[model samples]
Target: MAAENKKKEKTATCYQDCCAEVFNFYLGHSGEHEAILQCVHSVLPEEFKRIGAGKSSLDVLGVGSGGGQVDVQMLTLFQSTFPGVQITSDVVEGSIKLSNNFKALVGKTANLKNVPFQWHIMPSEDYVKQVKATEHVKKFDFIHMIQMIYYVDDLASTIEFYHGLLKENGRLMIIVETANGGWDTLWKTHSKDLCTHTITEYRSSAEIKACLDKMGLKYDEHPVPNTFDITNCFNPKDKFGCDLIDYLTAKEDFYASVTSEVKEAILDLLKNKCSSQKDGKIMFDSTLSCILVHA
Candidate 1:
């Protein structure tokens, strides 16, 4: 059943462009990623901390760097922590359109003086290939995969591949929206309205650990609560939330994969969910299952 479910999920199509556009808008204004980084880093004990460790130039890899919005927080953190030195940052994103937008975002932020980032615009599948060839072994100081695992075909294989990219003692940091948690529950409840795509395929801590054991990799999983309170971004008169309200109310045909009825259901659910919350709050409780691999 798991294998069949995984196959079904792999076949599911996402409204990637629409999702990215809406997500980027929220990211640009909400300071969401900064808060997430704070929570994400908390899950990792001293081992993930770069402080007091004699490491000069850090090499960091950020996967699914959508419009490079999250990089702002990451770059700012690196600069404040390690001054007067450039951290070689590599952004792995597949879309040329998104890559262009990312470049623009970087230019606006002055390209991070202490952190120079290069875009590796390759599909995640191809990236998996590099890992298989041992070409990506231990290449990054910190490897990040945030809200990206859902799009991949194989969770265990993808996790293993990213783990392979880490050097000895390197940290593979992940910030995944717990697919079966409150956030996902809400998203699923609104499936007929707001969700453009979804898959029940997920890895609990035990499941991921078992996969790691099979591959001879040891890892520690920490559960952290990830919250998004976007109340300020909403306007009562607006359709969905605020500036990107259209995204929330995007037409059914915008995501051709899903039936028109399913799309409408999702939008209605979004409205109802928002209505139920106090102060018209649009919150996503993205409980994170932070996995730390001792690569």
Candidate 2:
């Protein structure tokens, strides 16, 4: 009988109305921003530190640097690690809304006074194309692609191109959610409709590692443990519950198009498997994995 019921296709939305709210909701719950910052601060290599100690300038590229919040933290760390040095950062962000927010952040951030940044308002692939079209090639000392690979059209080629942009002894840091996490489960089961066309695949460090191995690339991995509360999601009376569910599924309003039975089943699965109750709080596991490759 259950098999006879057809599942509805997942709806895609730009989240124009809810992007800020959704991002804030995730930040409040996920601890993702802090974890990534800690990962970057701790994973910085000894040689880079030594080289930076004497260098007067550094070149950096940040892909998908949304709102520049995390990018600012990363920049702060770099500044502390290599004081009295000038950093030229090329930031690539596809969304104007997000890029504008990033620019606003830059304007007000006192710590960024010394950092010079070039904003590229386009997808990573387009940035690559534009750079390649230029007669001269620009190499970067560090490139960070944090939680942005899913949006790229060609994952492997894009990564390879970024790696190629690395100068001698330079490093590339890639961050993504773990395949064993709830994100992978949701995407694998419901991605057909829920996944946006701009987002090619929901990949994890595991998949990235395999690709690196196939290419004979050497890298290091760091586990960034994270947790978020989703107890509101289980509350029938909670107004934000639906929004949380939408965020989890990466849809506009997931319940709007889903069948009652399907929605109920998804809610059940999310409650039972994706999260756990502790002290009356429904906590969801949202761990991220960071990988570092050096050239």
Candidate 3:
């Protein structure tokens, strides 16, 4: 957020210190809401007026609402398109700070006057407890998990659990980054074995489909046009050249894997790779896959 820190991170790697780094990027990153909203629109029903017609309010649930940027965008879009729609959203997330921030942002906006929000703060395990209980099942019309399901050890069960939370015709959305980004290259070149993504099982869409089939759920998949572009991720003035080195390199093997020279080269490559070619703007060639299914 500070200019010096920004430069240290360069235009590329601003999210250095925490687990929700990229998620937070959506909150503070300029122009990202537009792209995110685009994805949301494509995934949501075209005629949401009929979503929960005749109901006093639309009840929705979000898993890993994170910084709540996605919810804000949805609220903004709904207010513009369906001005009279009342929304009651229950967000099941654990971070108290992020929840408070989401509350603060939504509370200040007049457009959200018709939207009521409730936070169900708990770990996924506890959430599972309430969800698995028959008395509290099938309570929501919509449930969404974006880039959050990967954390679950038993992903198929997690998917099924969300399915149990849905009311009839209730839709569940899953948004995840496909490994098609220069991610493979980054993983091979700069990323040490310390924190690699799940490349073994359940790595791609094919695998996801298999899991869905095993669960007897039908889904519609869409490719989102957003990517993680870290091209401007550098500051030659600093010793490590970027702030990412702080969080990314914690072990000796990790540090040993990336020397100063390799780091600089990777940064340069990221900058150039992320730069605009066809449209005169940085491009997120990164792939995103979303699924809408019976919850």
Candidate 4:
């Protein structure tokens, strides 16, 4: 009877309606972009040299590239690494708003002029299907999926499809949260109660590594340490805090939608289990792992 009551309890609502706004806020506070840039600059140059070796041109693919900020920087680095090589970049992004933002960024960025970009405004699955249906598809020398692996339906097939699309000496880069990261811990513990999104899966680097291992794919991993202030999350009156909670759970108005007990449980877990105190503020474990595969 107790279990039945628990099963019937109200969970959090999905936050798809305002996901962009919430996500932007989270990005601003998280310092994620800087950390990703650092990781990319540190690890990718040598890998780029390997991929661009003996080639006068390179094909690049960016999956789920949000707003094109990181994509532009990475492509710029690639161009610098192989100044004589011609680069073609293909971007697959599902969100219209983000796609527009990416286009606008590209327009203003003068460095990207030499590299032609083919924008595909669709989900990765759709893009994959379209490519598979085409008689002859372009193979990519460099492909990257940054912080967007959770949106894919089948991890194994997704990895396989992208890996199959790589040219000789090609590289595929994936960035996702670490297994013991705060987001991972939160979702692992309370996904049944808080995660109501049908599309987004709770995945981490550990899960991706497991899928690769199952497929007999070899890869290298690098840790990217990141954190964000979560002191506002404990303050019920802070709107940013409320939005952060919603984003964290991928839910809409999470604090108000869930049962009081569930809400309290999530808060306790966030404070005590998912974060640590630093400089008088609660810091979230936003640490991510970068995985690189050669094809």
Candidate 5:
């Protein structure tokens, strides 16, 4: 990003502007969602083995469940693990468009027809505030914060608050890019210009491990391997290419705003080191890690 723009207050990354583009990128680039699902599935079976031992229904909370794609996958996993058990899912998302899209998806999916879903169109902070003010004691069997904790102000406090909401043996799951991933590398390199409070700044599995350790919390971590094809990004002038770059960097059209030197430097790293050519395809590592903490 440009130095002048960086000097000014950074704007919040708006999902409404680029949600479709992001989903399309995910669909085209890599099997990130599936990889994440696999990692989560690997960890949950053991941690949640007691979920339906006697109970018939599960209470689930999905924080920042954009479009409900992953939320549906997790809920489906729960159902498959405990057959015939109903689930009441409370989806927390700030985007109206994405929430509506999720509802539409639920309406069309045959398996999800029986599941009851509640939509809370607000940020996690607001939801926490409301719960605290109302003295609501509703507890959940599972809570998933899928790549959403970066938007939170205080990670430790937020985890504590949600951790308290979990029933006995309940699991609080979190997913984030690994420290060695390109996303973390980009943030570590360009935090002064690109990083902001609204965007996820310090949210890698390694960092989260430190937080959990400091909080005296015990958890399990799983590493997921994934890759993204970014040959289109070799062209800096193309609008779609620039938009993809912005999406990857979590900035609004970052390539368009940066100087030629800055753009060239970033692109050079992406082409030369961050990504590798295989079968004439430039693939960038997009690995992620999932952590599960007990209540």
Candidate 6:
């Protein structure tokens, strides 16, 4: 009877709600933002120097700018690189809570006082549509989309839209998981069974590179090392662990929604295939790749 039940069970589909809480928790624990910041500091200054040459001001765009922390830091660095160059920044974020947080952060940060920011609370696709409808759309010298491509419907079109918005010698930067990373492995193996195809689309740097190549666009790629501590995920009673699992699986109430067999299979793969034991902790491979395209 047990064997028959297992055989008859259909794989549960993902149903994720607003992930702001889990996302915040992940950022606080995963150290992902810091890793990306390091990559930005290393690569962006040179690009800034090139773009800022013979320019009095720079226009910047930040897509999926969660909480605006990274955007603020990048702008601070850019201002330092080219002193007295005015910055006009436009941000697009889908979450109202995050957008509010970003605005509040910008208000408190003294360095960003001189920089003007225009906030657009919408998904990238909607923003693209709005831009298309406008007769004269503002172009950008620097556009950065970080870890948000997975939510986009069409990667190629999205890239084309943003690439078209770039000014001469401008740069567009996209950061995504590496093809061999833990998230990629999990999605590759279980996406067909678990993904909802609504909130998240499985993507990696490999696909982005291929799309850019097909479009005849030239880009440079940089690898950023990142890891997440998943030690709590093994504890059943831990709230953080449960939330982390939900975020990772891109599902809400993952364990409750799925069958025991399915849950076991996913947990097994996450533990054995996507993570490693290090100093009494499970370190998930959250390695990222940064791709930069010049226009």
CA lDDT of each candidate?
0.60, 0.75, 0.59, 0.85, 0.77, 0.85
What's the CA error at residue 174 for candidate 4, in Å?
Answer: 0.7
2 against 4, candidate with superior TM-score? 4
* Candidate 5 regions with alpha-carbon error over 4 angstroms: 1-14, 17-20, 23-27
Error of 4 at 246 (Å): 1.3
Which candidate number has the best TM-score?
A: 4
Candidate 6 has a TM-score of 0.91
lDDT tens readout by residue for model 2, 1-295: 5433311111111222347557767676668888877776777645358436556788889987877888887777778788778888899886677788889988898989878889988767678889999999888888888888776666678888999998877888898888777676666666665565434466777788888888788888888887778887766567688777777877666777777886787777676776678898877777888888877
Q: Please tell me which model should have the higher lDDT, number 4 or number 5.
A: 4
User: Model 2, residue 220: displacement in angstroms?
Assistant: 0.5
Clashing pairs in 3: 12-232, 12-233, 231-270, 231-271
For candidate 1, write residues 1-295 as lDDT tens digits: 9988865545433325565566566566545576566765565336545421577667878887766666666666666666665578888786677778878877777647445667777767766676567743547777877666656767777887787667656887666655465445544565445434343444444455667788887766777664555453344354344454343333333345457686556545444453335455656444667676777
**Residues 75-147, candidate 4, lDDT per residue (tens digit)?**
9999899886899999998777788889999989888877788999877778989999999989999999998
Candidate 3 lDDT by residue in tens digits, 145-177 = 865664555678888878877776678887765
Give the TM-score (vs. native) of candidate 5: 0.88
The TM-score measured for candidate 1 stands at 0.67
lDDT of 1: 0.60
- State the lDDT of candidate 6 residue by residue for 1-295, as single tens digits: 9866532221111112255766887888889999999998998889889988988889999998988889999999889998888999999887788888899999999989999899898778779999999999899999999988877778899999999999999999999999879999999888876555344458889899999999999999999999888878767689889888877886677778778887899898898999988998888999999999989
Predictions: Cα RMSD each: 6.2, 5.7, 8.0, 5.2, 3.9, 6.3
